[model samples]
Target: MSFGLVARAAGMFAVTNIDDILILALFFAQVRHRPRGVAIVVLGQYVGFAAILAAAVIGALGAGLLPESVLPYLGLLPMILGIRAGWKAWRERHDAADGDSPVGERSDVGILTVAAVTLANGGDNIGVYVPVFANSGTSAMVVYLVVFLALVAVWCAAGRFFATRPPVARALARWGHVLLPVVLIAIGMLILIEGGAFGL
Candidate 1:
Protein backbone atom coordinates (compact mmCIF):
# COMPACT_ATOMS: atom_id res chain seq x y z
CA MET A 1 0.00 0.00 0.00
CA SER A 2 2.79 2.42 0.84
CA PHE A 3 4.50 1.65 -2.42
CA GLY A 4 1.29 2.22 -4.29
CA LEU A 5 0.84 5.51 -2.52
CA VAL A 6 4.35 6.54 -3.47
CA ALA A 7 3.78 5.62 -7.09
CA ARG A 8 0.54 7.52 -7.19
CA ALA A 9 2.22 10.54 -5.69
CA ALA A 10 5.03 10.38 -8.19
CA GLY A 11 2.59 10.08 -11.09
CA MET A 12 0.58 13.02 -9.92
CA PHE A 13 3.62 15.20 -9.45
CA ALA A 14 4.98 14.33 -12.86
CA VAL A 15 1.69 15.06 -14.53
CA THR A 16 1.27 18.40 -12.88
CA ASN A 17 4.83 19.68 -13.10
CA ILE A 18 5.88 18.51 -16.53
CA ASP A 19 6.28 22.07 -17.77
CA ASP A 20 8.63 22.88 -14.95
CA ILE A 21 11.45 21.09 -16.74
CA LEU A 22 11.78 23.76 -19.40
CA ILE A 23 11.48 26.58 -16.93
CA LEU A 24 14.10 25.07 -14.68
CA ALA A 25 16.39 24.52 -17.63
CA LEU A 26 16.17 28.18 -18.57
CA PHE A 27 16.97 29.16 -15.00
CA PHE A 28 19.95 26.85 -14.90
CA ALA A 29 21.24 28.26 -18.15
CA GLN A 30 21.14 31.73 -16.69
CA VAL A 31 22.85 30.92 -13.38
CA ARG A 32 25.07 27.93 -14.03
CA HIS A 33 28.24 30.04 -14.19
CA ARG A 34 27.67 31.90 -10.96
CA PRO A 35 28.93 30.88 -7.55
CA ARG A 36 26.53 28.60 -5.67
CA GLY A 37 24.19 28.87 -8.61
CA VAL A 38 22.85 25.34 -8.46
CA ALA A 39 22.26 25.59 -4.74
CA ILE A 40 20.46 28.90 -5.15
CA VAL A 41 18.16 27.56 -7.82
CA VAL A 42 17.38 24.43 -5.82
CA LEU A 43 16.70 26.47 -2.71
CA GLY A 44 14.39 28.79 -4.60
CA GLN A 45 12.54 25.84 -6.07
CA TYR A 46 12.00 24.34 -2.64
CA VAL A 47 10.85 27.60 -1.12
CA GLY A 48 8.30 28.10 -3.87
CA PHE A 49 7.11 24.49 -3.91
CA ALA A 50 6.91 24.42 -0.13
CA ALA A 51 4.57 27.39 -0.28
CA ILE A 52 2.48 25.59 -2.87
CA LEU A 53 2.22 22.49 -0.69
CA ALA A 54 1.38 24.58 2.33
CA ALA A 55 -1.46 26.17 0.45
CA ALA A 56 -2.75 22.82 -0.67
CA VAL A 57 -2.58 21.42 2.84
CA ILE A 58 -4.39 24.40 4.23
CA GLY A 59 -7.16 24.17 1.67
CA ALA A 60 -7.45 20.47 2.36
CA LEU A 61 -7.88 21.23 6.03
CA GLY A 62 -10.81 23.56 5.28
CA ALA A 63 -8.96 26.79 6.00
CA GLY A 64 -9.55 29.28 3.27
CA LEU A 65 -6.40 31.40 3.34
CA LEU A 66 -7.14 32.99 -0.02
CA PRO A 67 -10.28 33.29 -2.05
CA GLU A 68 -10.59 31.48 -5.37
CA SER A 69 -10.95 34.73 -7.29
CA VAL A 70 -7.58 35.98 -6.05
CA LEU A 71 -5.75 32.99 -7.45
CA PRO A 72 -5.85 34.26 -11.02
CA TYR A 73 -4.17 37.51 -10.04
CA LEU A 74 -1.16 35.45 -9.11
CA GLY A 75 -0.38 35.50 -12.80
CA LEU A 76 0.53 39.14 -12.50
CA LEU A 77 3.57 38.27 -10.49
CA PRO A 78 5.27 36.59 -13.42
CA MET A 79 4.23 39.26 -15.84
CA ILE A 80 5.81 41.88 -13.67
CA LEU A 81 8.97 39.89 -13.31
CA GLY A 82 9.12 39.37 -17.03
CA ILE A 83 8.86 43.08 -17.66
CA ARG A 84 11.71 43.71 -15.26
CA ALA A 85 13.90 41.20 -17.00
CA GLY A 86 13.03 42.64 -20.38
CA TRP A 87 13.99 46.10 -19.24
CA LYS A 88 17.30 44.85 -17.95
CA ALA A 89 18.00 43.10 -21.22
CA TRP A 90 17.16 46.21 -23.14
CA ARG A 91 19.53 48.22 -21.03
CA GLU A 92 22.26 45.69 -21.56
CA ARG A 93 21.84 45.84 -25.31
CA HIS A 94 22.03 49.62 -25.31
CA ASP A 95 25.08 49.56 -23.09
CA ALA A 96 26.81 47.13 -25.39
CA ALA A 97 25.98 49.31 -28.39
CA ASP A 98 27.39 52.36 -26.64
CA GLY A 99 30.72 50.62 -25.94
CA ASP A 100 29.97 50.49 -22.23
CA SER A 101 30.21 47.19 -20.44
CA PRO A 102 27.10 45.05 -20.77
CA VAL A 103 25.00 44.93 -17.65
CA GLY A 104 24.11 41.39 -18.62
CA GLU A 105 27.55 40.42 -17.39
CA ARG A 106 26.14 40.51 -13.88
CA SER A 107 23.48 38.17 -12.62
CA ASP A 108 20.18 39.86 -11.86
CA VAL A 109 18.17 36.79 -10.95
CA GLY A 110 18.49 36.01 -7.28
CA ILE A 111 16.86 33.35 -5.16
CA LEU A 112 13.72 35.43 -4.53
CA THR A 113 13.29 36.05 -8.22
CA VAL A 114 13.43 32.33 -8.94
CA ALA A 115 11.13 31.60 -6.03
CA ALA A 116 8.58 34.13 -7.19
CA VAL A 117 8.57 32.71 -10.69
CA THR A 118 8.26 29.16 -9.38
CA LEU A 119 5.35 30.05 -7.13
CA ALA A 120 3.61 31.93 -9.90
CA ASN A 121 4.07 29.01 -12.26
CA GLY A 122 2.53 26.56 -9.78
CA GLY A 123 -0.90 28.15 -9.68
CA ASP A 124 -2.28 25.26 -11.68
CA ASN A 125 -0.55 22.74 -9.47
CA ILE A 126 -2.39 24.06 -6.44
CA GLY A 127 -5.72 23.54 -8.16
CA VAL A 128 -4.78 19.96 -8.96
CA TYR A 129 -3.31 19.14 -5.58
CA VAL A 130 -5.98 20.49 -3.26
CA PRO A 131 -8.71 18.03 -4.04
CA VAL A 132 -6.35 15.08 -4.10
CA PHE A 133 -4.98 16.05 -0.73
CA ALA A 134 -8.41 16.69 0.72
CA ASN A 135 -9.62 13.26 -0.37
CA SER A 136 -6.57 11.35 0.83
CA GLY A 137 -5.88 10.09 4.33
CA THR A 138 -3.19 11.70 6.45
CA SER A 139 -0.68 8.99 5.63
CA ALA A 140 -1.34 9.35 1.92
CA MET A 141 -0.89 13.09 2.08
CA VAL A 142 2.41 12.62 3.90
CA VAL A 143 3.60 10.22 1.26
CA TYR A 144 2.61 12.58 -1.49
CA LEU A 145 4.46 15.47 0.08
CA VAL A 146 7.56 13.37 0.56
CA VAL A 147 7.50 12.15 -3.02
CA PHE A 148 6.90 15.61 -4.37
CA LEU A 149 9.80 17.14 -2.45
CA ALA A 150 12.15 14.35 -3.42
CA LEU A 151 11.31 14.72 -7.09
CA VAL A 152 12.21 18.40 -6.97
CA ALA A 153 15.85 17.40 -6.73
CA VAL A 154 15.50 15.11 -9.70
CA TRP A 155 13.84 17.89 -11.66
CA CYS A 156 16.70 20.27 -10.91
CA ALA A 157 19.29 17.74 -11.98
CA ALA A 158 17.43 17.05 -15.20
CA GLY A 159 17.17 20.74 -15.92
CA ARG A 160 20.87 21.27 -15.30
CA PHE A 161 21.72 18.33 -17.52
CA PHE A 162 19.80 19.84 -20.42
CA ALA A 163 21.19 23.32 -19.84
CA THR A 164 24.75 22.00 -19.94
CA ARG A 165 24.39 20.19 -23.25
CA PRO A 166 26.78 21.66 -25.84
CA PRO A 167 24.20 22.80 -28.39
CA VAL A 168 21.75 23.97 -25.76
CA ALA A 169 24.44 25.79 -23.79
CA ARG A 170 25.69 27.66 -26.83
CA ALA A 171 22.20 28.67 -27.91
CA LEU A 172 21.32 29.82 -24.46
CA ALA A 173 24.51 31.79 -24.13
CA ARG A 174 23.62 33.61 -27.33
CA TRP A 175 19.85 34.07 -26.97
CA GLY A 176 18.82 33.42 -23.41
CA HIS A 177 18.46 37.08 -22.55
CA VAL A 178 15.66 37.41 -25.06
CA LEU A 179 14.13 34.02 -24.45
CA LEU A 180 13.75 34.32 -20.73
CA PRO A 181 11.54 37.39 -20.81
CA VAL A 182 9.42 36.08 -23.62
CA VAL A 183 8.82 32.75 -21.90
CA LEU A 184 7.92 34.30 -18.58
CA ILE A 185 5.45 36.71 -20.13
CA ALA A 186 3.93 33.96 -22.20
CA ILE A 187 3.50 31.79 -19.14
CA GLY A 188 1.81 34.61 -17.27
CA MET A 189 -0.55 35.30 -20.13
CA LEU A 190 -1.42 31.64 -20.40
CA ILE A 191 -2.17 31.44 -16.70
CA LEU A 192 -4.41 34.47 -16.89
CA ILE A 193 -6.31 33.23 -19.91
CA GLU A 194 -6.70 29.75 -18.48
CA GLY A 195 -7.92 31.16 -15.22
CA GLY A 196 -10.35 33.37 -17.12
CA ALA A 197 -8.79 36.46 -15.68
CA PHE A 198 -10.26 39.72 -17.12
CA GLY A 199 -12.81 37.61 -18.97
CA LEU A 200 -10.15 36.54 -21.45
Candidate 2:
Protein backbone atom coordinates (compact mmCIF):
# COMPACT_ATOMS: atom_id res chain seq x y z
CA MET A 1 0.00 0.00 0.00
CA SER A 2 1.31 3.38 -0.95
CA PHE A 3 1.70 6.00 1.75
CA GLY A 4 -0.70 8.26 -0.12
CA LEU A 5 -3.33 5.57 -0.28
CA VAL A 6 -2.97 4.90 3.43
CA ALA A 7 -3.21 8.61 4.14
CA ARG A 8 -6.37 8.86 2.08
CA ALA A 9 -7.76 5.85 3.88
CA ALA A 10 -7.03 7.51 7.19
CA GLY A 11 -8.80 10.65 6.03
CA MET A 12 -11.83 8.73 4.95
CA PHE A 13 -11.93 6.91 8.26
CA ALA A 14 -11.72 10.16 10.15
CA VAL A 15 -14.49 11.71 8.11
CA THR A 16 -16.85 8.82 8.65
CA ASN A 17 -15.94 8.69 12.31
CA ILE A 18 -16.48 12.40 12.95
CA ASP A 19 -20.01 12.12 14.29
CA ASP A 20 -18.73 9.90 17.06
CA ILE A 21 -17.18 12.92 18.71
CA LEU A 22 -20.56 13.94 20.01
CA ILE A 23 -21.06 10.50 21.44
CA LEU A 24 -17.69 10.59 23.11
CA ALA A 25 -18.21 14.10 24.38
CA LEU A 26 -21.44 13.19 26.04
CA PHE A 27 -19.87 10.16 27.65
CA PHE A 28 -16.85 12.12 28.75
CA ALA A 29 -19.03 14.74 30.36
CA GLN A 30 -20.24 12.04 32.65
CA VAL A 31 -16.79 10.91 33.66
CA ARG A 32 -16.14 10.66 37.38
CA HIS A 33 -13.00 11.41 39.39
CA ARG A 34 -12.40 7.75 40.06
CA PRO A 35 -9.13 6.32 38.89
CA ARG A 36 -10.74 4.09 36.30
CA GLY A 37 -13.74 6.13 35.27
CA VAL A 38 -12.26 7.93 32.29
CA ALA A 39 -10.17 4.96 31.42
CA ILE A 40 -13.27 2.77 31.33
CA VAL A 41 -14.96 5.10 28.89
CA VAL A 42 -11.85 5.25 26.74
CA LEU A 43 -11.43 1.52 26.80
CA GLY A 44 -15.13 1.09 26.17
CA GLN A 45 -14.80 3.11 23.01
CA TYR A 46 -12.12 0.75 21.74
CA VAL A 47 -14.17 -2.27 22.68
CA GLY A 48 -17.18 -0.88 20.89
CA PHE A 49 -15.08 0.16 17.91
CA ALA A 50 -13.65 -3.30 17.75
CA ALA A 51 -17.16 -4.66 17.46
CA ILE A 52 -17.87 -2.25 14.62
CA LEU A 53 -14.65 -3.13 12.86
CA ALA A 54 -15.39 -6.81 13.17
CA ALA A 55 -18.83 -6.41 11.68
CA ALA A 56 -17.54 -4.29 8.85
CA VAL A 57 -14.83 -6.80 8.12
CA ILE A 58 -17.32 -9.59 8.01
CA GLY A 59 -19.59 -7.62 5.75
CA ALA A 60 -16.67 -6.81 3.54
CA LEU A 61 -15.60 -10.40 3.30
CA GLY A 62 -19.08 -11.74 2.79
CA ALA A 63 -19.78 -8.90 0.37
CA GLY A 64 -23.29 -9.83 -0.67
CA LEU A 65 -24.69 -11.64 2.32
CA LEU A 66 -26.14 -8.73 4.23
CA PRO A 67 -28.83 -6.59 2.73
CA GLU A 68 -28.44 -2.86 2.44
CA SER A 69 -31.78 -2.55 4.16
CA VAL A 70 -30.09 -3.72 7.34
CA LEU A 71 -28.12 -0.53 7.37
CA PRO A 72 -31.04 1.79 8.16
CA TYR A 73 -32.48 -0.45 10.83
CA LEU A 74 -29.27 -0.05 12.75
CA GLY A 75 -30.41 3.53 13.30
CA LEU A 76 -33.12 2.17 15.51
CA LEU A 77 -30.46 1.21 18.03
CA PRO A 78 -29.34 4.75 18.69
CA MET A 79 -32.88 6.02 18.49
CA ILE A 80 -33.97 3.67 21.20
CA LEU A 81 -30.88 4.46 23.20
CA GLY A 82 -31.69 8.15 22.94
CA ILE A 83 -35.22 7.56 24.02
CA ARG A 84 -34.08 5.57 27.04
CA ALA A 85 -31.51 8.17 27.95
CA GLY A 86 -34.08 10.90 27.68
CA TRP A 87 -36.36 9.03 29.99
CA LYS A 88 -33.56 8.52 32.47
CA ALA A 89 -32.67 12.17 32.39
CA TRP A 90 -36.25 13.16 32.93
CA ARG A 91 -36.55 10.86 35.90
CA GLU A 92 -33.35 12.11 37.41
CA ARG A 93 -34.52 15.66 37.05
CA HIS A 94 -37.77 14.89 38.79
CA ASP A 95 -36.12 13.08 41.67
CA ALA A 96 -35.38 14.97 44.85
CA ALA A 97 -31.80 16.13 45.02
CA ASP A 98 -30.10 14.42 47.89
CA GLY A 99 -28.06 16.74 50.08
CA ASP A 100 -25.61 13.98 50.95
CA SER A 101 -24.50 13.07 47.45
CA PRO A 102 -22.98 15.74 45.33
CA VAL A 103 -23.78 15.71 41.66
CA GLY A 104 -21.16 13.70 39.72
CA GLU A 105 -20.43 11.75 42.89
CA ARG A 106 -22.25 8.72 41.66
CA SER A 107 -21.33 8.18 38.06
CA ASP A 108 -23.45 6.43 35.49
CA VAL A 109 -20.39 5.68 33.45
CA GLY A 110 -19.86 1.95 33.11
CA ILE A 111 -17.35 0.26 30.88
CA LEU A 112 -19.71 -2.33 29.49
CA THR A 113 -22.57 0.15 29.37
CA VAL A 114 -20.47 2.65 27.50
CA ALA A 115 -19.35 -0.08 25.18
CA ALA A 116 -22.94 -1.06 24.48
CA VAL A 117 -23.99 2.50 23.79
CA THR A 118 -20.98 3.05 21.59
CA LEU A 119 -21.87 -0.02 19.62
CA ALA A 120 -25.39 1.24 19.11
CA ASN A 121 -24.17 4.69 18.18
CA GLY A 122 -21.69 3.24 15.72
CA GLY A 123 -23.96 0.58 14.24
CA ASP A 124 -24.58 2.48 11.07
CA ASN A 125 -20.92 3.13 10.36
CA ILE A 126 -20.63 -0.37 8.98
CA GLY A 127 -22.22 0.92 5.83
CA VAL A 128 -19.17 3.00 5.10
CA TYR A 129 -16.59 0.66 6.57
CA VAL A 130 -17.80 -2.38 4.69
CA PRO A 131 -17.27 -0.86 1.30
CA VAL A 132 -13.93 0.61 2.29
CA PHE A 133 -12.75 -2.74 3.52
CA ALA A 134 -14.07 -4.55 0.48
CA ASN A 135 -12.14 -2.39 -1.96
CA SER A 136 -8.85 -2.71 -0.09
CA GLY A 137 -6.54 -5.70 0.03
CA THR A 138 -5.09 -7.29 3.18
CA SER A 139 -2.10 -4.94 3.33
CA ALA A 140 -4.27 -1.87 2.99
CA MET A 141 -6.59 -3.19 5.65
CA VAL A 142 -3.65 -3.53 8.03
CA VAL A 143 -2.59 0.01 7.27
CA TYR A 144 -6.14 1.18 7.79
CA LEU A 145 -6.26 -0.61 11.12
CA VAL A 146 -3.07 1.03 12.28
CA VAL A 147 -4.28 4.45 11.25
CA PHE A 148 -7.68 3.85 12.81
CA LEU A 149 -6.37 2.63 16.19
CA ALA A 150 -4.01 5.58 16.46
CA LEU A 151 -6.79 7.97 15.60
CA VAL A 152 -9.06 6.46 18.20
CA ALA A 153 -6.55 7.54 20.83
CA VAL A 154 -6.51 10.98 19.29
CA TRP A 155 -10.27 11.07 19.38
CA CYS A 156 -10.32 10.06 23.05
CA ALA A 157 -7.86 12.81 23.85
CA ALA A 158 -9.99 15.33 22.04
CA GLY A 159 -13.05 14.20 23.92
CA ARG A 160 -11.26 14.44 27.24
CA PHE A 161 -9.92 17.86 26.39
CA PHE A 162 -13.38 19.09 25.52
CA ALA A 163 -14.86 17.47 28.58
CA THR A 164 -12.29 18.92 30.95
CA ARG A 165 -12.77 22.52 29.86
CA PRO A 166 -14.36 24.24 32.85
CA PRO A 167 -16.75 26.37 30.89
CA VAL A 168 -17.77 23.65 28.45
CA ALA A 169 -18.01 21.15 31.24
CA ARG A 170 -20.37 23.39 33.19
CA ALA A 171 -22.48 24.02 30.13
CA LEU A 172 -22.70 20.35 29.28
CA ALA A 173 -23.54 19.36 32.82
CA ARG A 174 -26.23 21.97 33.03
CA TRP A 175 -27.80 21.30 29.67
CA GLY A 176 -26.58 17.91 28.62
CA HIS A 177 -29.26 16.17 30.62
CA VAL A 178 -31.72 17.57 28.14
CA LEU A 179 -29.66 17.96 25.02
CA LEU A 180 -27.68 14.76 24.83
CA PRO A 181 -30.54 12.43 24.09
CA VAL A 182 -32.05 14.82 21.55
CA VAL A 183 -28.70 14.90 19.79
CA LEU A 184 -28.48 11.13 19.91
CA ILE A 185 -31.93 10.75 18.43
CA ALA A 186 -31.04 13.18 15.71
CA ILE A 187 -27.94 11.17 14.95
CA GLY A 188 -30.04 8.05 14.69
CA MET A 189 -32.45 9.76 12.34
CA LEU A 190 -29.60 10.95 10.18
CA ILE A 191 -28.23 7.45 9.95
CA LEU A 192 -31.62 6.14 9.01
CA ILE A 193 -32.17 8.78 6.38
CA GLU A 194 -28.72 8.36 4.97
CA GLY A 195 -29.13 4.61 4.76
CA GLY A 196 -32.61 4.93 3.26
CA ALA A 197 -33.87 2.86 6.16
CA PHE A 198 -37.59 2.56 6.84
CA GLY A 199 -38.17 3.97 3.35
CA LEU A 200 -36.69 7.23 4.39
Candidate 3:
Protein backbone atom coordinates (compact mmCIF):
# COMPACT_ATOMS: atom_id res chain seq x y z
CA MET A 1 0.00 0.00 0.00
CA SER A 2 2.99 2.22 0.25
CA PHE A 3 3.68 4.79 -2.49
CA GLY A 4 7.19 3.38 -2.76
CA LEU A 5 5.81 -0.06 -3.52
CA VAL A 6 3.54 1.33 -6.22
CA ALA A 7 6.36 3.38 -7.71
CA ARG A 8 8.72 0.41 -7.79
CA ALA A 9 6.12 -1.78 -9.42
CA ALA A 10 5.42 0.85 -12.04
CA GLY A 11 9.08 1.30 -12.84
CA MET A 12 9.79 -2.41 -13.04
CA PHE A 13 6.91 -3.14 -15.37
CA ALA A 14 7.65 -0.18 -17.62
CA VAL A 15 11.35 -0.91 -17.90
CA THR A 16 10.85 -4.61 -18.45
CA ASN A 17 8.43 -4.06 -21.32
CA ILE A 18 10.14 -1.12 -23.01
CA ASP A 19 11.27 -3.17 -26.00
CA ASP A 20 7.72 -4.26 -26.72
CA ILE A 21 6.85 -0.69 -27.60
CA LEU A 22 9.16 -0.88 -30.56
CA ILE A 23 7.63 -4.12 -31.76
CA LEU A 24 4.16 -2.87 -31.08
CA ALA A 25 4.83 0.27 -33.03
CA LEU A 26 5.56 -1.78 -36.12
CA PHE A 27 2.41 -3.78 -35.59
CA PHE A 28 0.44 -0.60 -35.23
CA ALA A 29 1.94 0.83 -38.40
CA GLN A 30 0.95 -2.27 -40.29
CA VAL A 31 -2.68 -2.09 -39.23
CA ARG A 32 -3.26 1.60 -38.61
CA HIS A 33 -5.19 2.29 -41.82
CA ARG A 34 -7.61 -0.51 -41.11
CA PRO A 35 -10.87 0.12 -39.34
CA ARG A 36 -10.81 -0.23 -35.57
CA GLY A 37 -7.10 -0.88 -35.82
CA VAL A 38 -6.06 0.52 -32.52
CA ALA A 39 -8.61 -1.61 -30.67
CA ILE A 40 -7.40 -4.77 -32.31
CA VAL A 41 -3.74 -3.94 -31.67
CA VAL A 42 -4.40 -3.09 -28.04
CA LEU A 43 -6.38 -6.28 -27.54
CA GLY A 44 -3.60 -8.32 -29.06
CA GLN A 45 -1.05 -6.71 -26.77
CA TYR A 46 -3.15 -7.42 -23.68
CA VAL A 47 -3.59 -11.05 -24.61
CA GLY A 48 0.08 -11.48 -25.36
CA PHE A 49 1.25 -9.70 -22.23
CA ALA A 50 -1.18 -11.72 -20.15
CA ALA A 51 0.36 -14.87 -21.59
CA ILE A 52 3.77 -13.62 -20.43
CA LEU A 53 2.41 -12.94 -16.98
CA ALA A 54 0.96 -16.43 -16.93
CA ALA A 55 4.32 -17.90 -17.86
CA ALA A 56 6.00 -15.89 -15.14
CA VAL A 57 3.55 -17.23 -12.57
CA ILE A 58 4.14 -20.77 -13.73
CA GLY A 59 7.88 -20.30 -13.63
CA ALA A 60 7.74 -18.82 -10.15
CA LEU A 61 5.67 -21.70 -8.84
CA GLY A 62 7.62 -24.37 -10.69
CA ALA A 63 10.92 -22.93 -9.62
CA GLY A 64 10.66 -24.73 -6.32
CA LEU A 65 9.86 -28.03 -7.98
CA LEU A 66 12.64 -27.82 -10.56
CA PRO A 67 16.39 -28.03 -10.14
CA GLU A 68 18.13 -24.72 -9.50
CA SER A 69 20.13 -25.06 -12.69
CA VAL A 70 17.03 -25.29 -14.86
CA LEU A 71 16.55 -21.54 -14.68
CA PRO A 72 19.68 -20.79 -16.65
CA TYR A 73 18.73 -22.96 -19.60
CA LEU A 74 15.49 -21.03 -19.87
CA GLY A 75 17.62 -18.30 -21.38
CA LEU A 76 18.03 -20.43 -24.49
CA LEU A 77 14.52 -19.72 -25.69
CA PRO A 78 15.19 -16.04 -26.17
CA MET A 79 18.61 -16.68 -27.70
CA ILE A 80 17.12 -19.00 -30.26
CA LEU A 81 14.35 -16.52 -30.96
CA GLY A 82 16.91 -13.76 -31.30
CA ILE A 83 18.86 -15.75 -33.85
CA ARG A 84 15.73 -16.41 -35.86
CA ALA A 85 14.76 -12.75 -35.79
CA GLY A 86 18.22 -11.77 -36.93
CA TRP A 87 18.10 -14.18 -39.82
CA LYS A 88 14.69 -12.91 -40.83
CA ALA A 89 15.91 -9.35 -40.76
CA TRP A 90 18.92 -10.21 -42.88
CA ARG A 91 16.75 -11.84 -45.49
CA GLU A 92 14.33 -8.94 -45.53
CA ARG A 93 17.11 -6.41 -45.86
CA HIS A 94 18.66 -8.27 -48.76
CA ASP A 95 15.31 -8.60 -50.46
CA ALA A 96 14.57 -4.92 -50.04
CA ALA A 97 17.87 -3.95 -51.60
CA ASP A 98 17.60 -6.50 -54.39
CA GLY A 99 14.12 -5.28 -55.39
CA ASP A 100 12.83 -8.78 -54.87
CA SER A 101 9.92 -7.58 -52.82
CA PRO A 102 10.18 -8.72 -49.21
CA VAL A 103 8.02 -11.54 -47.98
CA GLY A 104 4.39 -11.48 -48.99
CA GLU A 105 1.98 -9.83 -46.62
CA ARG A 106 -0.06 -12.03 -44.36
CA SER A 107 -3.69 -12.42 -45.38
CA ASP A 108 -4.80 -12.32 -41.81
CA VAL A 109 -4.02 -10.28 -38.71
CA GLY A 110 -5.68 -12.39 -36.07
CA ILE A 111 -5.17 -11.63 -32.42
CA LEU A 112 -3.75 -15.11 -31.94
CA THR A 113 -1.01 -14.42 -34.44
CA VAL A 114 -0.17 -11.17 -32.75
CA ALA A 115 -0.22 -12.87 -29.36
CA ALA A 116 2.21 -15.55 -30.50
CA VAL A 117 4.62 -12.98 -31.93
CA THR A 118 4.41 -10.92 -28.78
CA LEU A 119 5.08 -13.93 -26.58
CA ALA A 120 8.02 -15.05 -28.70
CA ASN A 121 9.46 -11.56 -28.94
CA GLY A 122 9.15 -11.27 -25.19
CA GLY A 123 10.69 -14.61 -24.34
CA ASP A 124 13.42 -12.92 -22.28
CA ASN A 125 10.88 -11.39 -19.97
CA ILE A 126 10.32 -14.76 -18.37
CA GLY A 127 13.72 -14.79 -16.69
CA VAL A 128 13.22 -11.41 -15.06
CA TYR A 129 9.57 -11.76 -14.13
CA VAL A 130 9.94 -15.22 -12.59
CA PRO A 131 12.45 -14.27 -9.91
CA VAL A 132 10.72 -11.01 -9.12
CA PHE A 133 7.32 -12.60 -8.72
CA ALA A 134 8.76 -15.47 -6.71
CA ASN A 135 10.24 -13.09 -4.18
CA SER A 136 7.24 -10.79 -3.87
CA GLY A 137 4.62 -10.94 -1.14
CA THR A 138 0.97 -11.44 -2.10
CA SER A 139 0.16 -7.76 -1.70
CA ALA A 140 3.18 -6.73 -3.67
CA MET A 141 2.39 -9.28 -6.34
CA VAL A 142 -1.15 -7.93 -6.64
CA VAL A 143 0.21 -4.44 -6.94
CA TYR A 144 2.63 -5.53 -9.62
CA LEU A 145 -0.07 -7.28 -11.60
CA VAL A 146 -2.43 -4.33 -11.51
CA VAL A 147 0.33 -1.93 -12.38
CA PHE A 148 1.62 -4.04 -15.27
CA LEU A 149 -1.82 -4.56 -16.77
CA ALA A 150 -2.55 -0.86 -16.59
CA LEU A 151 0.78 0.04 -18.11
CA VAL A 152 0.17 -2.29 -21.03
CA ALA A 153 -2.48 0.17 -22.12
CA VAL A 154 -0.05 3.02 -21.86
CA TRP A 155 2.47 1.00 -23.86
CA CYS A 156 -0.01 0.32 -26.62
CA ALA A 157 -1.08 3.92 -26.80
CA ALA A 158 2.51 5.04 -27.08
CA GLY A 159 3.18 2.52 -29.82
CA ARG A 160 0.11 3.57 -31.71
CA PHE A 161 1.04 7.20 -31.33
CA PHE A 162 4.47 6.57 -32.72
CA ALA A 163 3.04 4.70 -35.66
CA THR A 164 0.95 7.73 -36.60
CA ARG A 165 4.14 9.75 -36.93
CA PRO A 166 5.74 9.01 -40.33
CA PRO A 167 9.40 9.70 -39.60
CA VAL A 168 9.47 7.73 -36.37
CA ALA A 169 7.70 4.75 -37.85
CA ARG A 170 9.90 4.78 -40.94
CA ALA A 171 13.05 4.97 -38.87
CA LEU A 172 11.87 2.17 -36.65
CA ALA A 173 10.98 0.07 -39.65
CA ARG A 174 14.43 0.62 -41.05
CA TRP A 175 16.36 -0.01 -37.83
CA GLY A 176 14.10 -2.04 -35.59
CA HIS A 177 14.81 -5.25 -37.46
CA VAL A 178 18.47 -4.91 -36.64
CA LEU A 179 17.96 -3.63 -33.12
CA LEU A 180 15.36 -6.13 -31.98
CA PRO A 181 17.58 -9.14 -32.42
CA VAL A 182 20.53 -7.44 -30.76
CA VAL A 183 18.42 -6.40 -27.81
CA LEU A 184 16.96 -9.86 -27.42
CA ILE A 185 20.36 -11.47 -27.66
CA ALA A 186 21.77 -9.07 -25.10
CA ILE A 187 18.94 -9.74 -22.69
CA GLY A 188 19.33 -13.47 -23.11
CA MET A 189 23.06 -13.26 -22.43
CA LEU A 190 22.47 -11.15 -19.37
CA ILE A 191 20.04 -13.70 -18.03
CA LEU A 192 22.47 -16.55 -18.61
CA ILE A 193 25.35 -14.74 -17.00
CA GLU A 194 23.31 -13.67 -14.00
CA GLY A 195 22.04 -17.20 -13.56
CA GLY A 196 25.64 -18.47 -13.77
CA ALA A 197 24.90 -20.63 -16.77
CA PHE A 198 27.88 -22.32 -18.50
CA GLY A 199 29.96 -21.45 -15.44
CA LEU A 200 30.38 -17.92 -16.79
| Clash counts for the predictions, in order | 0, 0, 0
Ranking by lDDT: 3, 1, 2
Model 3 clashing residue pairs (backbone): none
Error of 1 at 55 (Å): 0.4
Error of 3 at 86 (Å): 14
- TM-score per candidate: 0.62, 0.61, 0.65
lDDT of each: 0.71, 0.68, 0.71
lDDT of 3 by residue, 51-111 (tens): 9999988877776566777676666666766787789888778543342311125445657
Q: Encode model 1's per-residue lDDT on 1-200: one tens digit a residue.
A: 57887987886676557556656777787887888888888998899999999998987667234566655555665576668767887877544234222222435767887788788878756755665565566888898999999999998897789766746544433465576566556656766776688998
Better of 1 and 2 by lDDT: 1
Which number leads on TM-score? 3
**TM-score of candidate 3 on Cα atoms, chains taken together:** 0.65
lDDT of 1 at 37: 87
Q: Report the Cα lDDT for candidate 2.
A: 0.68
